[model samples]
Target: MLAWPAWLTILLLVTNLLSLAALFFVTRRMLKLRRQKKRAFAFSDYPVRKAKLEEIAPCFAMSGYGPSPDSEVRFIGGEGVVSSLSDRESWVMAALAKGVKRVFEFGTCSGKTTHVLALNAAPDSEIFTLTLHPDDLAATEFGFGDDREHRDIALSESSFETFYYNGRSSERHIRQIFSDSKSYNEAPLRGSVDLVFVDGAHTRSYVENDTRKALNMLADEGVILWHDYKPGVPGVFAFLNELSRTLPLVHIADTDLVMYRRVRKQLSPA
Candidate 1:
């Protein structure tokens, strides 16, 4: 049997260890809750009003017979495609592209959306798609406040040198601009684009920059769509929430896309 002192020592040590383990678990759980709270505070979706597809555009309204021809789009599955749009989102965009004369897209990741835009647009329509070349990631100008996670994702997604539309006939309609969107000039295309898709780097600075340029280039009746508006993507979620204050941004119901139609020409922020 152990001596009284030894028994006391063992009891104290065991008690200390159990207390430490409990404290460790409590600390871990507290940290997790704190992180969740911070995320909720930073990335919540209460700012933008959500709307059904028909509310955003008349083309999404159902015809008495069936889906309108404008809603019929040539679609490729997301299988083996990285960062592809959801089927519903693609349909919304393609339907919007129908009959549009000029479309501008920021961030041509895989060019899947660009191809869809071309397929649904008028045969003579031009699709201008911009993306950073994999070789030129060094040129990315990420701001200090940019979300680090998405900056990495932006670089990773830029790995495509050849896109989905590379050899297809849609290639004829797409003008691929290989440059960081921050450095690309929108002057030549100003007030001419009927549709604009802003899917570039999810960094706040990049979104702001591309949006300013999109506004400058938007035709009077043009539409702009921004992807990844959910809370999981902090950069897009927060930026668009703030943008909703000044612009009439609509979150498409059940999708991560936000839509805006210009009521009047707005000057780009200098």
Candidate 2:
């Protein structure tokens, strides 16, 4: 019943709204691509060698520890635990802990890893594990360019005030530090840690900051292990891929851990 002019006007209005909706979605997608491009530009992929377990340390060799005490470790299953490491990864870390005297951990999600480290370390060994205090979440300083999803994950993981090691015999060897890693002082412990585990916030800025401090804390011949190296973790994957260009980093096959060992140079005889 409407005039042709009025019908044409209605069609024009509907077309205009649909065009705007399409433009909005397109703009959103373009912005996402721009952010990803910026991240790629900031951190380029460098080939990281995938290494077998035995290649990283002799303790992992079948000949070296065929059901021996050196490779034995106390372990808790990943059941009901948040962000737990795979069984194989846990065993690898535990075996490595057996030979180290001083261990530094960047993040203690539930103190499960900390407990395992203490249980395997030498009786006199000291373990320092740092995590954000649940009460101090407000003090976290996430960078503007950090992955928003991981920022939320970091906060969620910091919700633990008490950890699995609380009241266990291994707690005697463990020193739990409640402080944001960015504000934690590493000067006193520089060049003294035998092992460093970098598993803090997965955001790029936090990972970079923690890695810098981990390197500073490493002793001669110390080893540094970083968790969550898969491509899904954009911050960790990109940063580590970029880091592999300058450091001898090896991604352990079948696991998400990347490792770097600092070997002392032997002095030449005169």
Of candidate 1, the 10-residue stretch with the lowest lDDT total is: 70-79
Off by over 4 Å in 1: 1-45, 63-70, 78-80, 264-270
- Local accuracy of candidate 1 as per-residue lDDT tens digits, 72-91: 76777564568878888888
Task: State each model's C-alpha RMSD to the native.
Answer: 7.7, 9.6
Candidate 2, 16-134: lDDT as tens digits: 99999999999999999999999886444425788988788876666643644446777875655778689888988888888579999999998999999999888999999999988
lDDT of 1 at 193: 98
Residue 48 CA displacement from its true place in model 1, Å: 0.6
Going through the candidates in the order shown, the clash numbers are 0, 0
